[model samples]
Target chain A: MAMSRAVLEGRAEDTDGRLLLLDPSDNVLVVRARIPAGETIRVGGGVPVPVPADLPLGHKIARRPIAAGEKIVKYGAPIGTATVAIDLGAHVHVHNVKSDYTPTYHLLGGEAGR
Target chain B: MTMRGWLRSDGRKGIRNTVVVGYLVECAHHVAREIALPFREEGVHVIGFPGCYPNAYAERMMERLCTHPNVGAVLLVSLGCESFDKRALERAVRATGRPVETIVIQGTGGTRKSIAAGRAFVAAQRAALDAAPTVPMDVSELVIGTVCGGSDGTSGISGNPAAGRAFDMLVEAGAACIFEETGELIGCEHIMAARAATPELGRELEASVAKAARYYATLGYGSFAAGNAEGGLSTIEEKSMGAYAKSGASPISGLIKPGDLPPRGGLYLLDVVPDGEVRWGFPNINDNAEIAELIACGSHAVLFVTGRGSVVGSAISPVVKICANPETYRRMEDDMDVDAGRIIEGRATLDEVGAEIRDLVIGLAAGGRTRSEELAHQEFVLTYKSFEPIGPACLPAA
Candidate 1:
């Protein structure tokens, strides 16, 4: 098994070169075959990012300039909206985005529907 | 490596001996509950749907479930005002050679009067069921279904895949295996369609997922649960990729609406989304309703996978819970069976965890009690909804 959290355990490889980007919606794609880190593979005819030695089977990789109000498309469906503008090739998730449900400060976390 | 079970004439084995007190519609739900409440210690479950609208799909589902091998006897309760075919359901139960009785609420007088009558009927049925001889059976006769609730990112890689392995093992052993909630299999339709046993069946598979997507899209809630986002899932499509893996690699044999049993079984998808307009908002309002659909499809037990962790068990069928995330498992250790998160943590491999789950499936099929069953956790819930009958391609080749 590979390392879980990319931030904590993933390391960029400096090996061979091959680049593949999934759909316009997906942030990442499978290696299809192995590629060494630091090797650059052009994606969407754009300049390639260093083959970050650490790519897992289903990990995410950024595609578009996701704006705050923009929808994060994957499998080409709207999952949720971005809370802040995210640069191209940047990781987009909770730290940069939030849910549609507003939080009520209840001293502690209030259970949903309470 | 196997265990023993009791075989029913219908070619199914029961892990637990039970009698289901079924209400044909909502009018009789309370009466049936009052009937079973007094026999709570006897493993009698009050299970029923409260739909007055006549649905052939729902009617057939109720019949198969009442005659399921797990049920020792059945008592039908009706409101007399509803459209549910009470006579057909009772006859179906009787044809299985299972003792059955029917009591109408209006016909029997009022609520208390009907409750009293129903209670007496259950007591008598309980006595008769005791006389049913235990027939020796094996794991090959078992059938299990699986579903995920409170899913997060971990569920796809962990519990879902592990349960898929178990389903594979059970099917290989000649035991029927089922997995449902077509609403969750949206984005994987093309891949899912290719796995159908036949091209026609593939089309049915595609339609089911399409219906689910359209239904949820209308509600503006893809099955991309909010908890999934917190657990690292970024998009509904990503979440769907994980959910799609639960069906294992079997060629889908049929597509059945709620309450429709697979004629035979290779792998079947239980389409829980409503057929027509979204009358209920979501076909299944909660997890237990999904579990109930599995029961309606004649599943003897359910494999419940959780990432955020759901501890609910069913009223009649047993739920073997598999936790996907190691951290969540650590927090809710008492509620789970196998931990698939071990693979990501380097404590186990997918193949290793898969084999372990297969082993547990056989063990449970052989009558080894699941934790939910042991805890006497019989959580039952039913609600009103309508579903249309399936298309021609829905069932497999004759």
Candidate 2:
């Protein structure tokens, strides 16, 4: 095989595309491109999955249901905790998954995120 | 579609045409510059490492890089007091049939005298290259490397994935692509290992990442920096996944060290984090060091993705900048080759942006000027380091 597999889907369709699911064992999918609304994305297998809105790359997508305050598993490691309950294929990013351990910094008037 | 490439005497085909200058020690840097500076009119590119310390790996890297297919000629500058094996370096370049010359500053008198002698050497070298015929090149002959610096949350989203698309196209065209820094790959080890062509290669991949983890843990830093926290990344592994995507979707053929050339076409990983207990302070002090290592590995050109916007390029190879953040792109479009941030703006598709990157690589290989090159962003730096060779496990079949 190759060093990494192309998603059954690829090249983010809109402003946001799918993050990568490097392994089937991975609980969270690393977004490959920004996900835009009104486009089909590959949620995992079977068919091209659709999105609610744009989800940026490097952000995670829920492979399964996750509860509020539950650890958000990505690449099998806890990237953060879900600030709110997450459903299958939910977009998991700073707005949703907040790091429980490391404190995030923000510049005044600059807001601290992508 | 398949592409053609220029074959070198050393049996490697390069994606771009480059000229390199070698500085034997920190003291001769001024002379080396004065030598190549006059030839700036003729696409005579200058690259060299300034080091007084004698390093086997350093010397070998220089030889290999000098003989790389991208390079058409080499000029070595020595101050006469350093330990760099100038004679051996010149011999290696000469053996490749690429014109090579060395000027000793002390023997020639001083900076002014050496500059005159060096300028003469550079003139002759450029003249020879001018006489060299341009061949129709193919994509399979391309050897490209990717790395990210000044990364922010946007980098992984827009910049890196766009590069991944470009990588996929280049690989499909039969190019040899490389992605590196095992320390960053710690969390993604299992994913990286599984892609190995063989189980033995998988084991080596895992071990390299493990070594990086241990090394970084000792240094009191994760590969993910404080800025990454400020930018939205949570862990080193997360950062690695972003960087790793730059390798594209090609099947990996083998594992190679900093100066090792790929035995065949496909993707390879450059284990920049040294083997054994880390003797060097940091295997690479900054991004340019990593860029230099990529050049040494036979990379004809490099794709650099940035979310925070870094503006440096390497001396020997061309650098193509891919910007991820929309805001950053707006601020740095003049510096970037691909405005991948547009992908995040809903204006461009991943495939569209990726194809642009692929076309840009071909354009650059066909002699189009990259923004980095046009700006003359020729930066080079090297330091002392020791590395034991990789065992047989680091190959495709092994």
Candidate 3:
């Protein structure tokens, strides 16, 4: 079998910043470590983009601009659809992306907008 | 290829020779626990159905568990008034050629009398089981199941995929591997459907996930728990992408319900969610509940991948904990068997971790105890649920 980590291993840093691209088709990068607001982060061999907000680890950040209601691709599959237009380096979370199978419920309050 | 194993008359082999003390109803749980308590040092475990009312699902699960390959004997504790088919269970155990005894609390006078009688029966059975003949077993004869719990952002990247690699190696060696929780596989149905061995099987795979999505939608909540978000997951579909990695790259051979066994050596998916309406609150109440379903389907061992760290093991089967987070593994190293998180930390590769997990499985089957087993983490929880019989298309070979 092909090396397992090679296909799915998340990246912490690659001389750019700690962002992981799970699949080549993915439009978002998983945060390997927490990033401070306004910090410039480079990912997927693309140009560096400045972070709009401080994001926790494991959360996602858009690698590039995405249109409103577009399917958000991660792991080479659609995890959810973008609720509104997402800009590069913007945090992609419940506020921006929502699950297509069922409503995504946030623990703090109500469900995300579908 | 041969390992020391208990050979049953029905032609099943067991890695561990265990005696299960089952309580037929809630009324008999106390006496059953008391009987198995002192023998905890031995391969004795307590299992029961809490409901006094008869349920077909419970009956089948209890029967399959009692006659599981790991069990060498069974002791049934009945309240004498419950509707459980104790006679049928006893008969089933007898057919498997294992020593079985029933102690009716009402007939035995009381709890004290029943406990005394049950203990003596256990002692006799234990002596017989020790003298039971053992035969050589092979890797191809084993059945393994995989499930991920307490998932974090690192799960999909590390532990789950490492487990998938191990699954691939096992399947290639002709072992029956099972991966479940269609509720968690929601958005990836289209991707998973393509991995089915046949076009019909692909349809069955997609339909199963679709059914789970609809059922969870009615419940007003996805299969995702709040802790999932705490660990970096944003939605059930995102968690699924990581969870789906546990299946590795094997072609799904079939789809099965709780008690259905795979016909041959290949990968299979256990449909944990029920067919019709949600009769019992949720498909799986907790992680161990899923482990129970895997056990009922005849899993000899379960590979549990956890990012946030779940320290649970099953009663009849051994659970090998694969930690996805390096930090979590550091805090709970004793509970874990393989450190897939090392891949995320750049200390090891996924193939290396997969090989480590594969070696661990072979070692456990050959009598090496896992950390969970050593710590006595025999967590078992089975709740009420309903399932219709599987169709011919479900298991084409069977």
Using alpha carbons, what is the TM-score of model 3? 0.93
lDDT of 2 at B297: 89
Model 1, global lDDT:
0.69
Model 2 lDDT, residue B102, Cα:
85
Q: Which ranges in model 2 have alpha carbons more than 4 Å from their true place?
A: A1-70, A74-77, A80-114, B1-6
- Candidate 1's residue-wise lDDT over B1-398, tens digit each? 44655557766667666788888887778788888887886779877767888866567767767877678888898989899998988988898788888888888898998888888878887887766666666655666788888776567666677677667767777766787877677667888899888899898888888888788777877665566655556556556666776777777788887777677757888888887887676678788888888887777778888888888888777788888877778898888888887754647766677778777766765657677776667776566667777888888778
TM-score to native of every candidate shown: 0.78, 0.81, 0.93
| Residue-by-residue lDDT tens digits, candidate 1, A1-114 | 121222122223421122223233444332323344565654444665555443322234456567788766543444456777876544455555443322111121221111
Q: Candidate 3: where is the Cα deviation over 4 Å?
A: A1-17, A33-40, A44-57, A108-114
**Residue B376's lDDT in candidate 2:** 80
lDDT string for model 2 (B194-223, tens) is: 888888988888888888877876676666
TM-score for the A chain of candidate 3: 0.76
Of 2 and 3, the candidate ahead on TM-score is 3
Q: Compare the candidates by DockQ and give the number of the best one.
A: 3
Question: Scored by CA lDDT, what does every candidate get?
Answer: 0.69, 0.73, 0.85
Alpha-carbon RMSD, candidate 2: 6.1
Please give, for residues A1-114, the per-residue lDDT of candidate 3 as tens digits. 222433344453542456777766778887766678788887655677777666665677787888999988887778888988998777777777788877766563322211
DockQ-derived CAPRI band for the predicted complex in model 2: incorrect
In the order shown, the candidates' DockQ scores are 0.11, 0.14, 0.44
User: Model 1 in CAPRI terms: which quality?
Assistant: incorrect
